[model samples]
Target: MEILERNVEKILAVLSLLAISLIFVYIFKNSDASIINWDEEKVNLNINDKVYENLYIDKINVPPVKAGDVVTITKKDFKLSDNNENLVFRTYGSTIDVFLSGENIYSYGEDLYREGKTLGRGYHIVKLRSLGDKTSDLVIKQRIVEDMSYRWVDFFKFTSSNNIWHEILINNVFGIVSGIFLFSLGAFGNLVYVVLFLITKKNNLHLSYSFATMFFIGLWNCTTSGIIQAITGNYEIISFLEYFSIYATFVMYLFLVALIKKKSGKTKAIDIVKLLSLLILIGATALHLSGTLCISKTIMLFRNYALIVLLVLFYTLYIDYKNQKKYENVLLIGNCISFALIVVHIIIHNFNLTEIMDITNDNLITIAVLVMIIIPLFLYFLELDEIEKYEMQIRVLKSLAYIDKLTGLGNRTSGIAYIMDLIKNGFDYYIVMFDLNNLKEVNDHLGHDKGDEMLVNFANCLNSSFSDDYCKKIRYGGDEFIVVAQFDKVEDINDNIKQLFRVIDEVNRDGEKGYSLSVSYGIASSKEFATTGYENVVKLADERMYSYKSEVKNQICET
Candidate 1:
């Protein structure tokens, strides 16, 4: 019942956070519906510029662009924008060229297309410098690779060079912000995993792989959003990272699940999937780098592969979760959520019916990716907390088993273990055995309570005397106690014995109780008795204690 309640609390907490986020989104969307006016900034490039709000485009299958490419051309007669302003074209896998009054002003990816190389995409910002000022003819020629034709430049934009980044950020705040958040979470998880691994020294590699999976997922998200490419304009590196991150995510996630299953004593069926993921990365990267195929074409293969693997994993984890209550329960939850979101996204994208109940599922991928990482991470921490509590309970039980109820010192069982450990290490130590005097008489005449009090008081004296790092004090039995210590010299034993005697005298000063505590002790040093073995040494100590008790009786008779 308690476990169910804890799980419910965590689920409610996550749902509440999502509700708060939806509220914020609602407020942001409703806050402003007006169009933005950029002319209010100090750099009023649009003031003197002849910026047209619309452009006329002609779709042409054309005289042919290779065999499968799509070519589009647009021509217009209008006044060119101000020389200070620039025409920016945000394009992907498309070769774009601008002509002002029949003279070339800007060209991008033309050589790549000519050389039959993949034109990885980024923004092409063109400078307008004196195109004869009068009504000039503008022409834009474009060629898009067939596989990457989905990403096309939809419109012509003119802005100052300084405002390009500002516009990019304004357009992609959510992507950049969410990307940073996901990446930050991955980093924090890594730090936590490191600390936890150092402390526990147990099977915890799953967390590291899980965090690595999350890191790459965030990298892919941010890079694919085009914000990083817009900022750096290094489309090649950003595109490489985007492809590499998918491969890494696939491999890391497989490893994470495999480790979890292995820990749960499951068979090694997932290793085949792990190998397939690795082969996909290696083969696709080799082909893409060799110009035989584009990485974009491999995305379909990855998606199909991921769908099959996730279904299998979902079924396996679900069965395991139902059959047994284990840590993998959290993994199953994350896996199911991700798979469901992915299936929804696939259906929406394929069927072209993204609008459901007046809401478009544009953020499904982001939500799925974040949910896949966050849910597992949160629930894993909860599982770890429970494991720590179990360990604490075990420690408490062990401590109770080794401790004496009446005296608080170690009991006879613990004393034997302590001495055995010392002998195992070949240490020269001294054993001091103590037997409380007149305990039987006190129990018979003054009652057992007073005898128990005397026994406790003497144990307290022994504790006060032998409370050093190398000393082990134990209540051997009823009215019998022992202190085993590693001392540099026999002289140190005498000093400790004197200290014990001093404490005993102080404890016996309670005359109002009509009783005093007394103990006869015997000392045996391992240095002298080791030749006879440890068992004989203990027997000798017992005999010497009885001899001392006899001497005490004789002295009392003389008095």
Candidate 2:
């Protein structure tokens, strides 16, 4: 029944994840949108003051133009069916102005350009309205800065205001949801760490690394989702976050890898990897900030470098697994899967393959990265399981150490420790020493097993006489026992001794066993023993117990 319930729970959990994934797919896929590929369309380009007609946008073989040069693209005989619709074009590396039939219609960054200002390196959206003409000429003039290698305009389309809003929401839904989910999970992980730290007062390195990695990855997802651009409408801020997130994510991942290696006690190789990763991150950040490298181009280069780092990390984990480091196995499996997915994504991305399930290969790689982040949480739980097992074993060993196997009383080792603790804490206690009388006679008459039976009866009588709250009983050694009782006065110790005699009498009267149990005892108070030390007090008690045993033997001989 329990197994069936557990299976049901597993099925429910899987269903929940699938349901959420389908919801994300639905939100990201359902939109009435169109993309006009410039590669397939006939366009004309004016590069470096030279005009080339009937050229494919992708096949344009113009020389690279210097900074401050002008480039124009003219698409003649263009037809417009909806005059009210907006024509949106995404462009890079230019300040653009749209002209319809040689008349100015829309200008992008013209005001900022005239003010001798810059919006920095980013993609800008240029929008213009149609003239309701069946056939008209469209001219796009751009003032190019830096090299013209990154200059391109594509995804041009006529869309209504409502349709445009739907397209933005649909396109960015996956990113926004994924970012929020990853960030929330990371934050929750940090919260759990805070709670555990408060309870255990130990810093856990894995949790820290997992939190940092997820946080930066979440930031990258949000920035790349396009939702930030849609909400803030600030391309500069979005662009900066986009580039910054890339470096931040890489740095945090390196830290996570290094931490894992450190935990495994194999840090030299990962430390080198961490140093190299940091250098690359720093170098990329410097180049982007110094304007020596554009954001898009820098990110492109970094991606290839990152792939190498990932491969190196995978190899390291593989080596660890080969060494039979059980903890590294999960990491190896997760990294292998993520690496395969990322490789496939890189291939599809580089070849410009068609997207599946309305998700680009880039999005697929993001999913794989998320899987990597989640794997650590599973490992953390596995570590917890091992810790719990270790604690259980320690508890069992502790039981064996302190408990007497025969009498179920505290053992001799624990008795001495208890006495020392009482002395150390200045606790006032009465030490009672006992020796079983005639145990050898009982063993000779019946058997050693019968002697053990008498010993058990004596232990029971001792337990019945003293409550645990005020007294502790120890099976000190063979045919001997010791009990420590806390009391304010000597009269209380006398009263307990009287009660002990009564309990022994009752046990003998019951006659459950063939022999009657008898014990010789001597008591010593802490007040008398404090000046003589607890160990000396125990020796004094042993001497007094032997004296009492001689008295009992004499009384037996006379009777």
Candidate 3:
């Protein structure tokens, strides 16, 4: 029945995830606005013999190009029916000047020959004035400011101003939403861990590293998806964030190493590799900030390095798993999936074969990384739950070991240990030793079970008379019991004993077991027996108890 319930819960969880994913896909698909693909559209371009032209721009092949080279595109037959509709031109990898009937309408980026001006790197959207029934040719003159092995435009899309923004949002909707989800997951994980650390006053490095990794990966997705560019329109900030995200990965790897060390113990080699990765990240950041190296140019190399480091980290975790380290299996599974996705992405990117891979507009790799982060975190939480349950079980077992089964009081071993602990701690306590009178006689006349009832009755009397905060009551042995209590004055102990006797008298009057219960007890104090030690005090209490028992026997004989 328990196994069936668990399976049902698993099925429900899978259904919930599928439902959310379907909803996400549906929303993204519907948000797309109308867009014109230049390659597919019937647009005529007049490119002079100096520049190459292709009927299908998507399949264009071209020669090498350097800075200051100009290429003109003239769409002569294009006409707009709506005069109020604004023209939006989008492209990448070069500075562009748009002209309508030989008049320059908009310009982007610095002059082609400018030395220090930053060149545009990613998608750019320029809005033009209303066409207004003008049959004039639409012309675009693009200057290649960055060196390119192939002189080809990556994207050229034509749309209205409103649709242009909408298209950008639509194109990046999955990334934007997923990035926010990842960020929120990371932030919430961090918040939970921070609260736990504050309450428990202990550090959890594994969760810390996991959250940091997720946060930076989410930030990276946001930047790469063009969402930040759409919102801020700051190329420099976007560019810097790209590098920052990469560096953040390096730091995140270091944290992962720290977590591994905490779980499975450290190795000098792993430590050295972590340090080297940190130095490389720092050096790259420094060079980029100083303009000594272009981050865009070096990003692929850094990614390659990061992939190598990730593989190494995964291998180390595998080794730890082989060594039977706890929770390593979950980490290994998550890391392996992430590693495979990274490998696929690298291959597709380097070969420019995203189309062949059918992953041109997909965020599968991003989702895989999200899974990579989430699975381990989920497993960690499960482990925590198990630990808590195990600890609770241990507490229960320990209590059982120390408690008496018949009377529900501390057993002999625990009672002795308690007194020894008090003596070692130098706490002053009054000790009371008790022995039930005529217990053997009751056991022989009635039964052992009835005698056990008497023992329980006496235990109930002790519990009713003494406060747990100040008193330790134990069923020391057969018919023998002991109590150790702390009191502000010696008279307080006497008063408590008088109260105990009254409780005993009340229980005797009830006569539920058809027999009267009686006890002979002796009291001693830690202060009075300081020179003799607590063990001797216990012996003295035992001797006085026997003496009291004998005196009661003589009174019984006389009666």
lDDT of 2 by residue, 1-38 (tens): 33343343334334334544564676457432244211
Q: Which pairs in model 2 have colliding backbones?
A: none
Q: On residues 313-370, what C-alpha lDDT tens digit does candidate 1 reach at each position?
A: 7877776776555555777877888888778766654444423511432356666666
Q: Give the best candidate by TM-score.
A: 1
Please report how far candidate 2 places residue 199 from its true position, in Å. Answer: 2.2
Q: Summing lDDT over every window of 10 consecutive residues in candidate 2, give the lowest-scoring window.
A: 31-40
For model 2, the stretches where C-alpha displacement exceeds 4 angstroms are 1-84, 87-155, 163-166, 255-267, 282-294, 318-321, 325-337, 340-361, 374-403, 407-559
Task: Report the lDDT tens digits of candidate 3 across residue range 251-368.
Answer: 7755665555564674455676688777877887676666555533556666577588777767677777777456657777877887787787766655555254323433655665
Q: Order the candidates by TM-score, highest first — what do you get?
A: 1, 3, 2
TM-score of each: 0.72, 0.64, 0.68
Best of the two (1, 2) by TM-score: 1
The Cα local distance difference test for each model comes to 0.66, 0.68, 0.67
Candidate 1 vs candidate 2, lDDT winner: 2
TM-score of 2: 0.64
